[model samples]
Target: MNSFDLSIETYLSNIHFGHFATLSIQAIDNLYTFKGLVLIPVLWWMWFQQDECHEWRREMVLATLVSGIVALLVGRLLTHWLPFRVRPVYDTELHLRFASGEIKDAVLTNWSSFPSDHAMLWMAVATGIFLMSRRVGVLALLYTALFICLPRAYLGFHYPTDLLVGAAVGIAITLIMTRDAIRVRYATPVLRWTERHPAPAATLAFILCLQLVTQFDELRKLASGVMKHL
Candidate 1:
């Protein structure tokens, strides 16, 4: 790590000031992994059958999912192909700079720390929400940065550069997915196919979501391993 990256990593790692704050950050860390997916339920609850933009919202949600998947893939490839870096808690040099008695999970091992998959997912959804509604998007972006991003950094699961690069990848993927050319060339055809076989499409989406929530870690590790060799 360079001087700036190490400095920020050191500063963030020392942020678990008190017991209450430590507990809160830990809770946020757990919640952060699913913050993006949480939007799915919110959209479902808020979706209106007669709304003029109903189709837009529906399409945006699918686009967000696809973009997140693309970001995940890109991040995994970079992480595996790039030089490996250690997490703060596991970094011998950085551990000395960490605040003791807070958020040290044994499972937080040293790994490829150039980019964070968690940030990619959260930012992808945040960007998608922005495209759908400006007000909600602004709020969501702030919420993601403050709650999800900060907690992960404070807890040492990612470095500042990791979060920054992951978010850039995420925003890029979502922006590309938002492009008219991509939508016309790919998304429209897929949407038309789904419309003709709504039941099957819905079933597949449901199954994919179910497996994601239940076996996320397992699948992620497997994907990383597969990507590493590819």
Candidate 2:
């Protein structure tokens, strides 16, 4: 590991018993709940759909979905198939737990903590949207930092390095997809014609329908996990 990685590990280790760490973990874990994950996306999409930049909305939506899915799949495969790392909660030597109190039985996984899923997801969304609107992009980045990154570290689910790496992956995927989308959506004569006379309402509806269909499998999985926990 490099000096940066070592520094992060040391920092995480030092905070094992801190009250702030306990609070951060709790806040971070709360974001994994169904409402935070699902409702936020729905509201975000709805808001953007109503924006005046309707022509760019489709590109933004497509980029967000494609980059997010790619990041998630790649992150999962890398974490699961590569050398696995136990979470701090499961590390007896670390003795990390809720500093406020003892945690109840929680569903834990023994996966590598190199790239945090939450960080990647939000970062992908932020990056994709940033390609569309700078203001929205800034807001998205802030949301990811305050809600996703900070909370995950506070809760011991991931080190700061994991979140940082995940953000990098998300940003990279977003940039690639956005560049490709621009090339495909604008470079073609037929596409340029369509853009000049955009069917915003119709396009928005179609994209929304596609999103609902594409998200069904993921939503089902999330529901199943919630049921299992319940």
Candidate 3:
């Protein structure tokens, strides 16, 4: 890490340990669930119900999500070309809140941490929202910075520049998606197909979402419980 990356990353790369600390970590780690799943939907729903252009709002929401996933993929590919770096905990002498009891699966040591997929996805959604409502977009940006980026840094998952460049990738892709020509050429067709087959489209979205987020405490527990009988 260069001085800029190291200075900011070091400033952020410390955490508390214990049960409460675990809870806090899990909560921040679920920033995607709230911002992407909860907040974005809520904002879109509010706008949709009030707007004369309900269909447009619906299509835009779907397009925005697609943009987020695409941004994540693009960022993922970018990491392969950059100098390799392991997750902060694995590569550096940072203080970590290992399994002090908030939860298990305390450390993920091998994953590449060059550009954060979380940063890319969250910023893509934020960019999409900002396109619609500046206030909501700014709010989402703040939440992404504090709740999403900070905790990941504190927990030793990423360097600040990793998150920063990932955000840049997301913003770039989302801005392209927001273009009128691109929307007319690409997004409209996808929306039309989705309108024609909402069930399959919804199913595909759920599956892709599963690929994006691997940690789900309740869901994992439920899956484990079900597997015990088999």
Candidate No. with top TM-score: 1
Instruction: Please state the error at residue 9 of candidate 3 in Å.
Output: 3.1
Residues 24-143, candidate 1: write the lDDT tens digits: 667766752446456555444433445887776767767766776787778778888988878766677665445434445544554577788777866876788788788888887887
lDDT for residue 81 in candidate 1, whole number 0-100? 92
User: What overall lDDT goes with each candidate model?
Assistant: 0.71, 0.62, 0.69
Which candidate achieves the best lDDT against the true structure?
Answer: 1
Clashing pairs in 2: 25-154, 25-155
State the lDDT of candidate 3 residue by residue for 1-230, as single tens digits: 58886666556543446778767676767555644565455444543475676656656666676787688777767777777777765653544333222332433444478788788887887878777778877888888787887777766677788888888988888888877777666667877887799899778866655544542335646876899888
Counting only residues 3 or more apart in sequence or on different chains, how many pairs clash (N, Cα, C under 3 Å) in candidate 1?
0
Candidate 3 at residue 147, lDDT?
A: 81
Q: Write the per-residue lDDT of candidate 2 for residues 1-230, one digit (tens) a residue.
A: 45664455556545664567566556555634421354236435743576576645665565566667677777777787767766554455665452323444443454577777667766877777677678777777787787767666655667677889889998888788768546356324433554576697458645653443243446657987999899
- Model 2 regions more than 4 Å off: 1-28, 32-53, 95-107, 180-230
Model 3 clashing-pair count? 0
Cα RMSD for predicted model 2: 6.4
Winner by lDDT between candidate 3 and candidate 1? 1
Give candidate 1's TM-score.
Answer: 0.83
Give TM per candidate.
0.83, 0.65, 0.74
